[model samples]
Target: MLSKNLLSEIKEKSDLLNSLKPLSPENQAKLDKKFRLEFNFNSNHLEGNTLTYGETELLLIFDQTEGTHDYREYQEMQAHDVALRMIQEEAAETERPLLENFIRDLNAKILVKPFWKDAITADGQDTRKQIIPGEYKKTPNSVRLSNGEIFSYSAPGDVQKEMAELVAWFNENNGTEDPVLLAALLHYRFVRIHPFDDGNGRTARLLMNYVFAKNNLPLVIIKSAAKKDYLAALNRADTGDLSTFVEYIGNQLLWSLDLSIKAAKGEDIDEDDDLDKELELLKQELNQVPNEFEQEKTYSDVANVMENSIIPLFLELNSKIDKIKDLFVKAECNIQISHVKPNGYHDQLFFTSDDFLFGSSFKAYEIQAAIINFNCTALKKTIRHKDINYTLQIDFDGYNYRISNKFKNEELIILPYKTFLSKHNIDSIVKVVVSYVIDEIKSATNLNI
Candidate 1:
């Protein structure tokens, strides 16, 4: 419920905007552009879309994207724009009722398509989950907050029932309540439910604006720059302080109202941060020019690889496996580099040479000599404990770097060569390496974990 003074304030602004009949063509275009950019850029940015305001404007208005963003990010921005226009059209049809399918369609539209995302389970295990856009989640979902606490949303089982109830509540009180208040409450309620797996926040904002559009009010923009405040308000609402969030939302509506009045009065409606956004885009464009010549890979590059990637990798494995060394009768760790034999039966087999060893620094000449003497097929680390053996290997063939062990293998191809063997990458390899050794021990010893 809104305070009487706030309601009166909103009514006054609404009345003034209404008195300005139809805005001129120029004013209308300016207002549309402003609203479109504000809504699209902020809404998606709140959900971690990396496009800057200038990039978003370029993509949405000029249909020319100027960034190295993921293709999906660009697609979602365009899809969200389409959904924005769609809701405006829907809002114009007064006879049309808000339906669950319509809301689901908005979710589907903004998300673009189904895809898989990396997720962490409640037990803190890494896993992949498929996002089915426009549909309710099939499994449970939760988020880890800034404070490192897990916040779970409404369970998947209750989504359909709660959503139906939400829509009914909104439609029942649609025209009677103050439009801004209604929009605010509608946004909060929809977010509380979190109906869709992904895009719930984006969808909630869209739905909130739907109420404003239907009531002929200026749609509020939740600026991404103020995400902390926005989320803080939502957090307060979670603790039964709904009015705090309502007030926060009301203030955002005031901004939209103020901008609308300016646009209606044919005044300059450009934001204060517009110049900053332009300069940022200018800098990004200036930095995107390519160097004239490409650097060739040399022996020093291999030596750097040995120092930065291979040596650290072996030490990391040694540190982890050293913890369980007591369980084995005897544990030995060795570095093995593959030497491929042309037109031989064991061509693919990796054989160890005295030249390649872990923890030993190799000079540029030494790396050159090793590569020249041995037809290097792969680099491998093998841990032998009693009769059990475990291996972690990197198989690179000029095109892809594939890290494989007994448990799992991952291809680190998209990342740059220098950064392909990152800490996270090494951790993943180490995890599987440790898990493989543990599993082998368990199998041989028949020990219950």
Candidate 2:
């Protein structure tokens, strides 16, 4: 039915029965919203609907339309979304079997009102075909590809038996086949029949997901982006390469399942990651995007904080440190910020003070140690206040923080600036790193204001 490894991976990751068993009804409904919007937008978009995702969201969520689309486009987007939701409701009705009537209802929901559409007839003459919503085609239908070949569906005379056969095959295999295969084959078979006059593709997709939903699996989308591969995969099935389409559907199932998992975990799902280029997707998968873009943005944010805020901070503290340059007491000291290392180098949040003398009883290094120890104490107190789990390692080379009690395979570096900016409203980086160090120094060195 499908690749054993791929199926195994999906089963392992999905664990749908166990994973979904514990979720509350509200959580389930919340999860459905994400699928409904993306599925509706991408599905309609593939069929040449001109609504942007934002516009679709606007119309669906707020009843406020945004785009200059034909009113049919708006109605279809709303209708398509409703069909998806209705299928979910139908799937919930235990007694409702997959049937021609159910499929037509979905198609009718897609068009809302029937109208005539223009098409090229078999003899290559332009003609207007009467479209009765949810009804079978009275005349035959076929697509003329770019190369001028016609890919035809069942003849008008044959659609009835073919559709009956399609429904029976789906119902017979409904609980018997691997669900991903069942869904993909159901779609391929139905599309081959071109059973409805206008909403064949949309109905195929809605039926595809209904198969998954009935099996307690999460729904998957054919991103409009995967259009090329989506069509190619279907064409492959036409020539009897069903595995390619099965894998395509399998991949989409995996993709949606992963997205659902991360979404459930409350992680940010990137919109650009949803589909592939050329945008024809049977909801196949996109590879993992490099974190390079996000990491670069983060680096930029950190750099902005340093340049605009952190540098001036150090210069101000250095000004105060500049004043102490004149006084010569018993011991001279320098304040240096470097990595908490045995003998290493660093990024130069780097500050060092000119020699400043205290009294006879003070050793320079001892005073520095006292300052470091006090800073450590204040850091620990602050960490406790924030409820972070880490320890400060203070030494002559300077201080570093690490997760002392937590363990992970890869090191999790805590860039002080990243932590600073990520918390937002980090007005002063110098206030954080410098204040703790300098305040402790002044107190421990017994320096008066």
Candidate 3:
């Protein structure tokens, strides 16, 4: 029988559990597998056992009846092992910098391990190596997963810097705001960075759960079965869109919370609440508050909106231009705008003017204009006033194609018929670029228009 203290502790945990809804049997099974794996990994390490990839994965198999054939994948084994070790090390650390150092160290090791020999040529020549700040020259490779898709193994330099900044920011704001949302944002941002040439997905998932563990929440696993949805969530995040990923992960977390709550109560789990409704309600509440006070908006407010919001928009826009440039051969177009020289100027039109707009507003307008210009230039040809279809030659297919249009903007340059058809087929790519621009614009200005 459980002791009085154990029962009391269980009751205390139950009270916390009451705050969550129940989860489905499928979700419950997933949560159970993840918890078991995490538990076994931690327990083994605590008992002074060095864990391997195979062992880590076997721990995830709650029942052996399904057959162990699928667990034969070596990469999966390696990924699980590294992920568990990182989680264990993070859980063991009490200090922030130390925790970060451990994570970074793990990231470096995972990146170089599988691709080490391949990272160098047979002649002993170094291949494409990455320069991590403290880790020095490390080999980063693009490894193809079992799904035939390739992913990089090293954290990009910019992503590493952003992660460092985010870690610092978290240390400063950890207790002041809601930890769940903070953790979500951290997870979203980390995955968006896609750091590491190889284990980025697994590492990101671990880091996300690490944030949850820091907040005393159960670990959330994005199972291989949910890999498609997971990738979709991440792709949405890549374009600075968080709604899908947030909804997806939040649901997973709520499911875990429910199961843990049920286990605490020593009762058979029934049903979990739909977190989407609760999340929507929370978002609505957040939207009602002034941007200056909202936690997500705090960085924007403190950083003068321009540096925090506008510059990122510009960078996002630049990335879009690069994408559009890639679709067309011999269609080299450089998009740039003159920086607005600050002179004490104020008026509605002046505020709207390219010359007078400053800070975030300037950044927003410039990017918005650049995107519109690029799209229009890619589509339209000659501008016509009144009823005339003005004729003009626009570059397409390594040849200038004669085209006409009824619009007045010279900024519009229409590609030829064949070129337009070919480009339209890649509409998803275009949507990604446009969505990236839109997300950045919204982030920078919060301009509903």
Candidate 4:
């Protein structure tokens, strides 16, 4: 339903960008970095991430984070970057069909993990609901409009059916339809469905770009500054005028094309505002007190936490695993220490003894993280699976400490330096580890217990 004029404009821009073909490696890399930062910063900012553009660049590119925002904000930004890379890789597989599970995985990657969120019930009562990543909503969701009216999405019971139809329509018209229009429609339909409890907006944007990437078109960004216009276009689409939203997306695509074409011609693509923003950030950094910037724990602090908190947690985990060891033919637990040496090198050294900390050599280096691996060999004729291995990892980034499994980069819990680790922390860590072990045992041994 796009007007001929708009469609022609989009075609012209697309052709112009295509004519440039491959850009220089250096130029392409610069463009990629620019878009990565811009996309991550703007998309999350639209959804209320408090990290500034400069802070986003530092965190994503340099692994250096600043500001005093909740650690969850930082974690979500990183997770969104992961989801971006995932779509890029996924788009490259031209032969593979896009499926519901892939979309679910994308949602999971963006949200990072299941957690509870505050919500308002239909009767206007405030409540909290658990958001399970990669799954359709079990509870209904709605939004409040600028006019103070409630705007409801598709009902929870109807979501599965609607989503199946949406995916089918997308796959059916994917190639034949104009990629820009296809991207816009995909975004609109997904938003209408609101399949997940949280992260629906972010997920919708990613899926829209996935369509563009598959078509080898420039990735369109919905600038956070222009969020009002973007929402207005969606509101217009809600009234049955879908073409306006398509035109809005087409215009955004044109912006991307213009930027890409400039990069192709070796022109400066950075806006004047970028420098101004950088200067503002510099001023803020200079005005802050010294203690405000000292958010990260020192090597000595790391040593203290490992000794006082981590060792006890590890011992507790070992004791719990020991109780379940008899269920398998061969079950063993081991510990490995990860730390930075005096030479500024990172190393992971194996430790065999339960009292491994008693050695003087352990205190010689700066400890950063620890790993515990539990390995089990299933009893023949007793268990079907041959071997089961699970790993728990605890590490401190410069700004925060995290506990997670070695196989997955997802953090189970992120703790700040101020809280460090308490008895409550130890209990939470042990609970997760023990639960995972039990689940793995049940799956491997087929025992209900």
Candidate 5:
């Protein structure tokens, strides 16, 4: 099983990856080329688009030995090569091929081979002798394996449904969860299913790497030297234990993250920055802000500010939005205070679109009055007395004015105003809201209302 300490280390590695900025276009192209090279190295066996146990093993050995082996090695390698090539050729091309299609293709190819189908003979008698076909041994259709026995291969019928479910799950959740964990789960599940007649291990690893590439992560290699530990993890997964598999995959993810981060930084990965702690603190601070705003701030208000105001502000401060830390510091503003009492209070405040009220606890009418005041100042218009009840209205010229008292709060709805304003970019409304709030707070507190 993977220790908790190792899991913590993996989390740190993931945090480091998340902290990285996007690479430059030139660097991105370079990284893509490197990734493709590694991918091709691992996937080159399927050049014929068919696979069988023999062909798969041949490719595995070829990848390991670079085809520089002696006669004995070549004989052993032939089984793997033949198996993989047959499988690839039989697999039907589809717009979106599935894992089962790959396995079924391999199975059909291997089953038709006379060498695989014919019973072995000993002592000139056709006494059936067991032979290891491709890479794995066959068991009775309903039998299970004991310790030290060959890896049991299941027929295509036994695993088709399970494989389909796995692929469906991967497609749906690929982008929703952490990619590293998602890949790990997929890898473990695929290996546990063990759906192919042979070469299931290699195919499972290939699927794992496919998921990694789909998620824009680096490719992971399961070395032959580590095959024992890999099988142990799969065994644990078979027994419904996943801690070991999670750890094994988490370690691979850490390695990928470390390499990618190093390449991006143009140096060895650093450990000094406590990014997780910093992020935690920032989240806590954001959570402390209350939801209520005196000026009726809707969900759209915050979204607008973040997307248009905050994002652009950061973009202007730095060429890219990667320098979020600096942007936060620069965007900080003091909260202006405002107070309002019932007596002697104007029904509405006049303000322009440029005013922003920061903090004020007053009735809606007082808030409206402050907005009117600020709007009149910016528009250079005279303040006209009107009997508008709790509604504050602003014109297109950045002037804030109130309707007559006959205007009812219920009828002074925002739908028409919203529809009219939508023609202009919503950011313009955000600026108006910010300015209105700032002025309202100042006016209410100054006049003790």
Candidate 6:
């Protein structure tokens, strides 16, 4: 049972946090980087991502790690950063409501390039299975309890229907509910849905915070050290006991709120208590651990992997996106990837075509990600929904970029990538992205109406 006084204190702290919304851009960047590192480290650590917090810090902040680990670990961590940024950018970029594709994109970002994983079956049998990113589970997914029984989620056939219901429920009740409550509910519900095979927990947390971001609420990052308690809270929520889990999430959120408040006040947030000491100790621990599982991969080896794997994927995506430029040319939309060095960053890094709205130009790596912006009357089309005329808008609305032509954005139907390829085939990904944009354009047309 949570103390009423404690709950009241949380509410008070949250109110104080609400009063401090819109942290200045400079302070926002500082706190954003800090929270991004801490949250990414803790979230991944909870999922058994082998990198230590110090290592995560080194990689994210300095773009290098002090020690070596699995290449997948590095790749996935970077992918997570990208996904986190995607959620943040999508949230900050516009006021569109959440979309299913954004969630799938985030899932894909969790595991940048998917592969197979050996696993345990529901009957306690061992087997091998492929893990597909950016899609719902195709096989049965459940948790094994200590008693050897299974805690099953939505069956493969029911995932889509249930997820649709979940989204509809959220869309209906989200803004009306308390932000913390809504976040906790979203987290618990997603866990129950267990939509994806792996990275469900991480993805759930991301979606939870994505809700918080939508509400202008401080995002919570559960501490890895609190894993035992965290799982216990989740279990409680699983068993129809929700208050405890809500309280747990509330406490975590309160901590984040306090941090934001501190940053808003211009207080030095770099060091508090033994954080510095703890990080140093963590670094020392990482250093002492033998690299027994180390691979013989070098920078050249990584570069080769990127060249053979990631670059081709990017190229394919670029090709698919570029093909759509001419279609938009008739609409007079500016589509360009904003290219810039790491330091002179703008809204987005990718700038491939001219007239990509929300993308500007600068130069750094010639082949790096460029912003895919659509501006200058890209969203000028009007549509009729429920007898009300609306103009289509394709900017990121806190949750997902959708066609905001009417009061509610119409569905942007995108076909799934037809085939799965392990070599990071960009065709499917680029297809989904471009298809979404195309659907946005199609949905805004008055033809059907």
Q: What TM-score against the true fold does each predicted structure earn?
A: 0.64, 0.59, 0.40, 0.63, 0.38, 0.60
- Candidate 2 structure quality by residue, lDDT tens digits, 1-449: 68889989999877854564555555555666668778998899777675656456667876875424468989999999889888888888766788788898899899999788766666544467788899998897877554546667789999889899888888788777888998999999998888777888899999999988888788889988687889999989989999999999999998888777766665554456434211211101111122233332233443343333333333444554344333212112222233223243332222233222121111111211111111122222222222111212222111212111122121111233233222111212222333334444333332211
Worst 10-residue stretch by lDDT in candidate 6? 411-420
Q: What's model 2's lDDT at 87?
A: 82
lDDT of 1: 0.70
Judging by lDDT, tell me the better candidate of 2 and 3.
Answer: 2
Query: For model 6, how does the per-residue alpha-carbon lDDT over 330-420 read when each residue is reduced to its tens digit?
Result: 3222222223445766543322333223432222232222122333234433422211112222232221122222233332211111211
Query: Per-residue lDDT for 1-449 in model 3, tens only?
Result: 22344335444554586555365576557556547564444333221223322234433442211112223233344445555657656755645542457556656544434332223322323354434422422333343333434444334456567667767876776666554556667776665554544344445566677777766667765644354677677667656777667667666666566568766545654333223323322432333344442233222232232333223433443455565443333222222323223463322221111322353443322211122123312211112211111211122222212121113222122222222312221232233335434433322222211
Report the lDDT tens digits of candidate 5 across residue range 1-449: 45667767766766676677586666665554444333333333222111222223334433432112223333333443454443333322323434555544444333333233222111111123233333233332211233313333344455656677877887677568765667778777766665543445555555566556555556675543354677677778767888778778878666667767776766533233224323322332333344343244433443333333332322232222122223121222211113243685544332222233342222232232211211111211113221111222322111212111122221111221122222122232233233333334223222100
lDDT of 2 at 65: 56
What's the CA error at residue 232 for candidate 1, in Å?
A: 0.7
Instruction: Tell me the deviation in Å of residue 230 in model 2.
Output: 0.5
Better of 1 and 2 by lDDT: 1
Clash pairs, candidate 1, are: none
Give the clash total for candidate 5: 54
Clashing pairs in 4: none
- Measured by TM-score, how close is model 6 to the native structure? 0.60
The superposed Cα distance between candidate 5 and the true structure at residue 80, in angstroms, equals 12
Stretches > 4 Å off in candidate 4: 280-449
Could you give candidate 1's per-residue lDDT for residues 1-449 as a string of tens digits? 67778778877887898898589999999999999999999999777676667678879887887635578989999999999988899999998889999999999999999999765455444466899999997776666564546677788899989999999999899999877778889999998888877898999999999998998888799997798899899999989999988888888888888899999999999877666666555543543454345344454555566567765666677666566655555554555544333343222222232334434554423232111011111112223223556555554333223344422332211222243365544664465455555554433332211
List CA RMSD, all candidates.
12.2, 23.7, 22.0, 17.4, 28.6, 22.7
